[model samples]
Target: MLSHLEFSGFYFIKNLHFGELGFVQSAQGFIFLSGLLVGLIFMKRHERAGAAQVRRRLWGRALELYGWHIGILLAILALSRLMPDSWFVWNRWLGRLYDGGDVYVAAAAALLYQPSYMDILPQYMAYLLVSPLLIQLIATGRAAWVMAGSAACWLAVQLGAHMPLVALLDGLWMGGATLQPRAAFNPLAWQVIFVSGLVAGALAARGELQPRRLLDPQRPMLFHLAVGGLVFFLAWRMAITTGLIAPEVLERFQAYENRVEFGLVFLLNFVALGYAVAWLLVAGQRSASYGLRVGATLLNRLLSHPFLVLIGGYSLQVFAWHVVAVYLLRLVDWHVGPLAEPLNSLLAVAAIASLALPARWLASRAPTRLADAPQPSRS
Candidate 1:
């Protein structure tokens, strides 16, 4: 959700600009964690219910995501129709839908056309659709092969193998309306992160990987290395963002840190940060140092706050609502012009706070809302 806020140009807290802090973004963590939770939860389900049941459940989730995607698109289309022509003219993303006519709508419904802030769901749907197979491979002791295949896909994407397929689909379906690719997040490249988390979660589920042992404070070598890497990346990020680095150098760095491709720098930074965090969390409970323990406790409490947990528990609903909020906020910006200072901050706060509405609604209907129920295991 912080990611959607960042994308929407809402920096409610200027000092803590999370989006600018690293080579990686929240989307990577979101996708990775989603895959992790799926692996952790569904693998156990697979064991109890068998592969057929697991496939049914995962595909059902994809269907749910599909409903949200189509529903949001329909809502946006309705708004475009009801709003003034100038509104669509101001928003090229919305304008393209009308410009391309029913063909574009069909493409969107078919998940081939995704507008800004609306692409992630399609990628997630793709992941969920294939997760059963990947999980099955892992369950059947071919986890290494699954990882290798995922890495190969990512490598192929890095080598530009995915573009031809995207181009083919666009040419076949979009006609001459526009020449741009539909997806912002390339699932082929991003699957490496997801599959990594999935494999980790599956291993942890089967007791092949123990979190405590992996993060044990006694083994300080890897943790120290992780800290060093985190510091280096953080310093580099600060240098670029603060203009401490020259513009030419920054441009080159940016070129290499492609988010769509899940560039090498991002993958490295994410790994470093992940290890550092895990170590900190583990040390919080097991460390001899009182200060470290206290600090970690506070951080954990802040993260595990009821409101945040509420938003997390109903992640899909909150995510869909966030996309809608971003679009609605963009529409407001187009009409009212850019909001300044505290107003923008307040708007950001309001928008983030509004996510609770859907969460609360889902919570209220929890007894019957099996789709929105909390997963068996989430970390």
Candidate 2:
């Protein structure tokens, strides 16, 4: 559903004219879940290998990501040169991305070169680069101090005190404008989330998180309903009382504020929403019906095997296709039939499905050396 929604260009719920908060909620849930999973994976690895080993591995991955990013830039440059008169126009879109100044902002979103998923790879690399420092800070058992320190750094950036080192590595783009409270993708702002992930990872590694045993099946439906109502009311009332109830604010809260340098309030929302989603998934796994099971299986499969489930596990190919399509559309400046939107959507989906097949096939076939392992003889 999310894959379809994304390709269909329904990023924001409001874009679909839906007053319901489901879309934003789902997106936030996904992002927060991603962070949690990242933390869990790394923390577990860290525990097994010790911080030194984990840090070394992560550093290698970070370097690989940097190389990959440069490769992406090269590919974009090559494609542009090769197809000089092709259907797409990269220059205009890139210009818009530089300043958020574009007339067709909606159409050429990916093409415009904003800090989206592709760009987010580098953002994640930034966090990985600083992983050891963040891990050490959190390990000191002074999470509060770390948060405060992160906040201070963010404030410095907001004050336009640029960190040249990070800029040299991650490039000049910071999160959405407004530096105060240091929200957004700027390393200064994002340290909070990265640290938070580290803390969460540490907690998870210690097996400190309580399992979802409280939501037993014996619990009455009314009890669950009442609790849900209470949460909703509290969220709504708090928003109203604070007078920061804008769509962006609501969206952030719904998603878990890990937005691309989104605001502080939004960031808080990100945390809240993360907990909410975690709770929901826990409860749902235990209490939901067969339909939910089927739906979840599909969703999990797609997320787990994105390349196989959607197209090919690589979203880059899909993205590159979109860029080419946009270029074509712009070349003729043609907005002619219904076919444009529908066909584009179908093609994207098809790309995802087709790519998934090859990816799955490749994954299934392991190299003989990797598959070979010495067996221990039984006494």
Q: Among these predicted structures, which one has the highest TM-score? A: 1
Residues 1-379 of candidate 2: C-alpha lDDT, one tens digit per residue: 2232223232232234211332233333433444555567766766677788768877888787666655554455455557645213445434333334442233223222432233444556666777766565555566567668867876665555665554442332333342221112455565566666566666566576444543343443533464465466456645655776997767655453333444454454455545443444455445456654464455555456534444434444444444334444443333332244556455445543444543445556645546676667898
What ranges in model 1 sit over 4 Å off? 1-15, 174-178, 367-379
Tens digit per residue, CA lDDT, model 1, 1-379: 4455432344556445565677767787888998999889988988898999999999998999899889988887777678665355336565467677788778788877677778888989999999999889999999999999998998897788887787787677757445465667788888898999999998888778888888776676787898799888889988876779988888888776888788778888998888777788776566666876786788788889999999999988898788778777767766775666777777777887999999999788877878667779875
CA lDDT of each prediction against the hidden true structure? 0.80, 0.49
Predicted structure with the largest lDDT when compared to the true one = 1
Clash number by candidate, in order: 0, 21
Candidate 1 local Cα displacement, residue 89, angstroms: 7.0
Worst 10 residues of 2 by lDDT: 175-184
Query: Residue 66 error for model 1, in Å?
Result: 0.4
